[model samples]
Target: SDYSQEPPRHPALLVNSKEPFNAEPHRSALVTSYVTPVEFFYKRNHGPVPIVDDIDKFSVSITGLIENPKELCMKDILRLPKYAVTATLQCAGNRRTAMSKTRKVKGVGWDIAAIGNAIWGGAKLADVLELIGIPKFSYISPCGGKHVEFVSIDKCKEENGGPYKASIPLSQATNPEADILLAYEMNGETLNRDHGYPLRVIVPGVIGARSVKWLDSINIIAKECQGLFTQKDYKMFPPSVNWDNIDWSTRRPQMDFPIQSAICSLDDVNNLKPGKITIKGYAVSGGGRGIERVEVSIDGGKTWVEASKYQKAGVPYISDDESCDKWAWVLFEAEADVPESTEIVAKAVDIAGNVQPENVEVIWNLRGILNTSWHRVHVQIGR
Candidate 1:
């Protein structure tokens, strides 16, 4: 019953779970700013948050596939180059409740606000590894590995009854421009206990699961993460599959999330007043792909209207003249006049031409991990 070490959360958050806390802010209250306040940021935890005693003395072990298998204290990591990355962390289950409507799925049912944007400041994961120095040797060195695994301090029963762990491809981890961070701070302040106090892996443009928190060790392995999450979950399946005939092996784990956008305004249909109503929300594309357009269709997908766009100040995910990287999200707003009743829907198109499917049936899976289908909200339009 005692979650004192879990960090104080905003009372306004809609409680999803208590022990391994999982909650999200009311959608309307969360869209006032481009940067989500950490307190109101959605909390998704799979296990008990470990109580860290000494943050400054916190150490992380780097082992396997590298010449210098050394330990890095907090001080050692800070000495590396510091970089700032603005990104949005969305649980793979964001909007699972919507998918649950079509058919029952076994997972946390998160609404639209299950995603939040934050400014992460820390040493580049690549730079820190460079300082440690990977031995100049063949790929088949003594402990040659193709993936970088991050093991968190939090103990969870779901993951083989051990600490939670996840991994990214070595190529992605080694790329300087990959923008991966050994983040210690969030929104210009020290990370809250609930958000990984001492350290966490900030894997931009990827699912939040990949960003392991309370990072205790880094393992380089020749194979992808064998963690239960990587192996048995976060995957997509066909509509026909059920528990009896399910085969997780046939499907690959979800890495980069596809194009996603949501309507964060107007929580209830009865709350609608009348006439033309202005709606606001956020949109994001994965894998550094930018949102080229966000279209809102109050009359279902038959007709659409372009939404005015906004991105985090100072950081532009997409730019002109020269090339810049995009791992963050873009906020948007659209105004429309409504009548009696209607289905308000919005879909996003990323720069890569990825569009959200018009309906959930085509994208529906058993677990509802990646519900990137067009986000919709039915409203009995008021007078």
Candidate 2:
């Protein structure tokens, strides 16, 4: 059975791009409950999945501006102490559909499903860098001047480039709070080929594109990655900018997702025998600032109500100690008296005073990113 060809069985999935790659997820999966299982998690890929047969032979190379360029085999990397984190990976284009609604955009028409939460286990990037004599503070000092570039093992001969590569600012790469990982395992098992086998980079709090798959090499530099993924694509621009007038260099690569949230439930229009309808969803902010609160609005953003709150997803250690962890998502819920109306709308706010926009038009960009507007659902009210 080629599991790769199988379609996802989740009922709530909203399909976006489909081909050698498919991006989708249960719209309400994030807040319907905590702990999104590996199977139900969203999948995003830039190319066909590569098949790897030998884990022992696989190795990762660290090069560029480092004092000692080192190549470590998978077996050696496993010898070090391992840590686990429950982090969410969201594609920069997660809500492309919301942008398309306003005007035509240029890439995969992703819905909210391009995001997923996972419990990743691997050696901390800082610990590894320390072994190679890379100073922890060097990332922060502008004088040291280093950028960490991630190169995927997956390769293809493209008309314009060699393979997909992405980079993050050195400060983000070395932050202990970032919890960056040379991940060999996902959801407790070895990574699937589509997910990057042998090794991959898991960069928490950044867009998914930066977390390159099929890990091969890490290079330190004084400038941002010039690859297509980092420079020519995955950026945000004013909604007024069109394809003909786009100035790629004027835009910066996206990092640190903005404060965002969505509604996960609605009244069953067909069976409208409801006393009350409950709203549930997840809210999160990037750059390690935990979600402070989630507020729900029933009538488009005119009136607001507070939702019940809980810890972010994939946090297994939260049960043991809460203080050690500072970031993730906050699940929320609110119940509203269902009026005999045609539709219900919901929006949420995060800790940093950032609230979802009232409508998509106000925040819509040409690339279809940062679509954190109110999510609406239509339902009939009858017995």
Candidate 3:
């Protein structure tokens, strides 16, 4: 089935699926720059892309819990105060391939490159909502609205072949720290169709799935969104639970991702010199948490050396002022002397003290959604 509507993509992308145009670049290409180039920003779509022939006519409805439930066209969006923020967007299943090594898990078998960082520009969702009038940011409004739901124009089987929708707690939606945006631009230009042109919501510090593409409508309601995506798909399960025994309701929807780091320098079967070897990778934590440091171990997890890390755009492999909020990821590198056959393991610790688990068995689940365990790579000692 021809599920995609966008034009041709870069040939270098390691395509995961063509129906929805899901693809990613190699880990080396992904970390080439602090703000990943938009062309290689790792497209992740669940359904057929909508054909928006008229960019100006693309309008989104803002209904529910508002004084004016009206339709907003592109003009309406650009008229608002625009702001740009540099952040990383990562799929919940970014490292599913690693999890599958331990046990079979269902979902896209993504490699380390399923994530990308970029500078996004748009009108703040809060400002857009205020135009229609929020009145108050109470825990629960008098009208019984406690959540803000985002609906996408794309239809998928996950919602029984209907529209894709999800929500965030109203408190979080209205929080200034949340930095939610109705984004229209990536880098310095308009967004590409594959990356949600015209308008799309950017739920910073959350999984990429929650940032629904192809603008449609939004609603403020009581209770969480009941869309299949919010209710069934992104929830995490314990390692003991299989599909047959899964109690979907018992688990909470994943909001912020866990501490994750990976070794992107050397690949399996790749030849490396016998002397001092250098390893490079990226590390990121969810919910605006900063990475304390990344540790690399040449002889497995027995001993570790802190990797040099820098979190800034415009300069690659160079450390910036360490005071910036951790909205983006930290690109890091570490060196160790190599001997015979060996494996290198890397893990990151977040500001909140969360460290990557040693392996997937401790966090494995049927879906294999969040596979943020220690990342290991094997290399051959060569001449």
TM-score top scorer = 3
TM-score of model 2 (CA atoms): 0.89
How well is each residue in 1-383 modelled by candidate 2, as lDDT tens digits? Answer: 12254333455555454444665765655665565666667777665566667777778898988778999898778987887877777888877776787787777777666777777788878777777777664556653356889887665433142557888878767776678988888889877666677788888877788888888888887888988888777787877787889899987888888877766654223346546877776666676666655666656556777777666444422212455244456666778876775456666555566767777888777778778777766666676
Write the candidate numbers in order of decreasing TM-score.
Answer: 3, 1, 2
RMSD from true fold, candidate 3: 2.6
lDDT of each: 0.83, 0.71, 0.81
Residue 239 in model 1: lDDT: 87
Question: Which 10 residues in a row give candidate 3 its minimum summed lDDT?
Answer: 313-322
Across residues 1-383, which tens digit of lDDT does each residue of candidate 1 receive?
23566767788899888877899999986678888899888888887788898777789999987776999999998888888888889899999998999988989889888889999989888787777784322233223348889999888868755898998877778778889999999999998888887899999999888988899999988888888989888888888989899988887677798899988886645456558887778889889888888999988778999887777444544433134437777888889988658888888898889999888888888888788888777778555
After superposition, candidate 3 runs with Cα above 4 Å error: 1-4, 135-145, 313-325
Off by over 4 Å in 1: 1-4, 135-145, 312-325
Q: Cα deviation of 264 in candidate 1 (Å)?
A: 0.5
Considering every candidate listed, which one attains the maximal lDDT?
1
Question: What's the residue-level lDDT of 269 in candidate 3?
Answer: 53
TM-score, model 3 to reference: 0.94
> Stretches of candidate 2 above 4 Å error?
1-15, 140-144, 156-161, 267-271, 312-325
C-alpha TM-score for every candidate: 0.93, 0.89, 0.94
